[model samples]
Each structure stands twice: as structure tokens, then as C-alpha cells.
Target: MPIVMDVDALMEFLRREFPQVSEDFVIEEVTEELTTVRLAVGERHLRPGGTVSGPTMFALADVGIYLAILARLGPVALAVTTNCSIDFLRKPASGRDLVSKTRILKLGRVLVVGDVLIYSEGDDRPVARASLTYSIPPRA
Candidate 1:
């Protein structure tokens, strides 16, 4: 599918519909097959061990794929994640921005599937991998 929204437009869409979290994520790259997003790691995002937490990374992948879906389908406000499976491969580096690079695997009328690899910024190894399934709302 061709892209219906770019990085700036996706950011704008998030800000307009989901203002509470729009600031937590940065839309870095958007395209037909891939969408990249970054989370600015703050002290609150760290675990007791001073490493980025799993939930934080999960949120990154969730939001990144949401943008990937929106980029293809426009602003479908009711689209929701039907399922997600994630693996934490390694400890994420501390106090660095986390980046989620998401690739869409399937886009159907009601379901979307995508794979996400999350890295601690500047690291070559992925800290986690996720496969997500989203349910798209039907149009009226």
C-alpha cells in the first residue's frame, strides 16, 4: 500500500487525537513498508537496575505500529491492537533514546500484522522484538 501520511502528518494526527501521549513519542520515519519511532528515555522510564524497562519498550512498539497502520489507512481512530507478542532479547542500554523500527507484514480489511525490532539508540543489537496484530474498525 502507498503511504497516506508522512512523518509530520502522522505526528500531527497523534497530537490531534491522542494528546496525552503525543509528546512521549517522536515519529522518525514513515513509509509504505516501514515506520520508525523514538521514545526519549527519561528517568521515569528506567527500572530499578537503571535500564530501560520492558513496558517502556512495549509501548514503543505499540505506538510505532499504530502509526504504521495509520500511515496506510489514514486516521482510523477506533483501530485497536488485537494481539501482541514480544520478546526481550537483551538488556537495553541506559539513559538512551529507544527506537522502534516497525515493518508491516500484512494489511487486510479487518486485521493488520506487523513486526517490530526495538533498539537502544546507537546500539547494533535489538533489545526486543514484537509481532503485533491490530483490528481495524469498519467504515460506516
Candidate 2:
């Protein structure tokens, strides 16, 4: 499917719809097949061990897939996650941003399925993986 929203449009949508965490996320790249997003790590995203927290990584994956869906479907704020499974494969590097690459596995009329792989900035190994299903809201 072609992308209806590019990186700039996605970033604008995030800032308009979700101002609270919009600044933390950067829509790095958006293509027909994949979308890449970056999370600007801050002190709040770190655990006691000075590594990125699981919840933080999950948030990146979630947002990454969400943006990927929106890129193909346009600004569907009502589209919401129906299912999510995440695995923390390895500990994220300290004092670095997190990057997620997301691609849609299936794009149906009612549901969208996708997966995201997250890596610490400058690292080759993925720190986490997530599979997500989103329910697209019915159009009136």
C-alpha cells in the first residue's frame, strides 16, 4: 500500500494529537514498507540500572506501529491497539536513544497486524521485539 502520510505529516499529527509525548518521539523515516521512529531517551526512560526500561521500549514499539498504520491509513486517531506482545531480548544501552523499525504484516479492512524491532542507538543488536494488532475504526 502507498503511504498517505509521510514523516513530516506523522510528526505533525503526533504533535497535534498527542502533545505530551510527541516531543520524545521522532518520525525518522516512512516508506511504503516500513517506518522508523526514534525515542529521545531521557532520565525518566531509564531504570535504576541506568538502562532503558521495558515499558519505555514497549512505548516506542507501540508508537512505531501506530505511526506505520497511520502512514498507510491517514489520520485515523480512532485506530487503536487491540493486541500486543513484546519481548525484551537484551538490555538497552545506557545514555542512548532507542530506534524502532516497524512494518505491517497484514493490512485488512478491520485490523492491521505489524511487528517492531527496537535497538539502542548505535547498536547493531535489537534490544526488544513487539507484535501488535490494531483495530481500525469503522468509517461512518
Candidate 3:
């Protein structure tokens, strides 16, 4: 299927619907099978050891998959995450923005499963990997 939402449109939809988190994420690219996003790493995203926090990484994965699903389904604001499994493989580079490379494993009427690999910006190795399942809201 063709992508219903492009990066610019998806960014607008996110800003309009979820302003609180809109600025935290930047949509880099969007396609039917893949989506790329960046997290603007800041002071709040770090932990006591000066490394990126786990929750921040998890947030990136979640948002990446969410946007991937939305790319195919349009501005379906009601889609929600139902399950996630994440592995933290390495420490993220300090003060560098993180990138999430996401792809869909399955897209269904009520659910979409996505896999994500996260890396520090400019780094070649992944810092974490995640598998997420989102429950798409039923159409009216």
C-alpha cells in the first residue's frame, strides 16, 4: 500500500494532536515499510552517569513504531501500543541525538507489529533494539 502520510504531514499531525511530545521527535523519513526518526537528546534525556537513559531510548522506539503505523494508516490518532520488548545493547553516545530505524513486521486491521533498531546519531552500531505491537483503533 502507498503511504498515506509523509514526513511533513505526519509531523504536523503529531504537533496538532500531541503537542506535549511533538517537539521531542523529528520525522526524518517515511515509507510504507520503514520510518526514520530522531530524538533531540537533551539534558533531561540523560541519566546520572551521563549516558542516555533507558526510558528515553524506549520512548524513541515507541514513537518510531507509532509513526511507522501512522504513515500507512494516515492520522489515526487513536492507535496505541499494546506490547513491547526491548534490548539495551550498548551505551548511547553522550549528548548526541539518537536515531530510530523502524520497519513493520505485520500490519493488520486491529494491530500492527513493528521492529526498531536505535543508534546514536552518526554512530554505525545500534544501541538498542525493540519489537512493538500497536493496537489500531477500530474504524467507526
Instruction: Go through the candidates in order and give each one's C-alpha lDDT.
Output: 0.92, 0.95, 0.93
TM-scores of all models? Answer: 0.97, 0.98, 0.97
User: Which ranges of candidate 3 are over 4 A from the true structure?
Assistant: none
Write one digit per residue (lDDT tens) for candidate 3, span 1-140.
58998999999998999899999999999877679999999999999999999999999999999889888988888899999999999999888999999999999989899899999999999999999999998898
Q: How well does candidate 2 match the true structure in TM-score terms?
A: 0.98
Candidate 2, pairs of clashing residues:
none
How many clashes in each candidate? 0, 0, 0
RMSD of each: 0.8, 0.6, 0.8
Candidate 1 lDDT (Cα, whole model)?
0.92
lDDT of 2: 0.95
CA shift of 57, model 1, Å: 0.8
Residue pairs whose backbone atoms clash in candidate 3: none
Clashing pairs in 1: none
Q: What's model 1's TM-score?
A: 0.97
TM-score winner among the candidates? 2
lDDT of 2 at 113: 97
Better-scoring candidate (TM-score), 2 or 3: 2
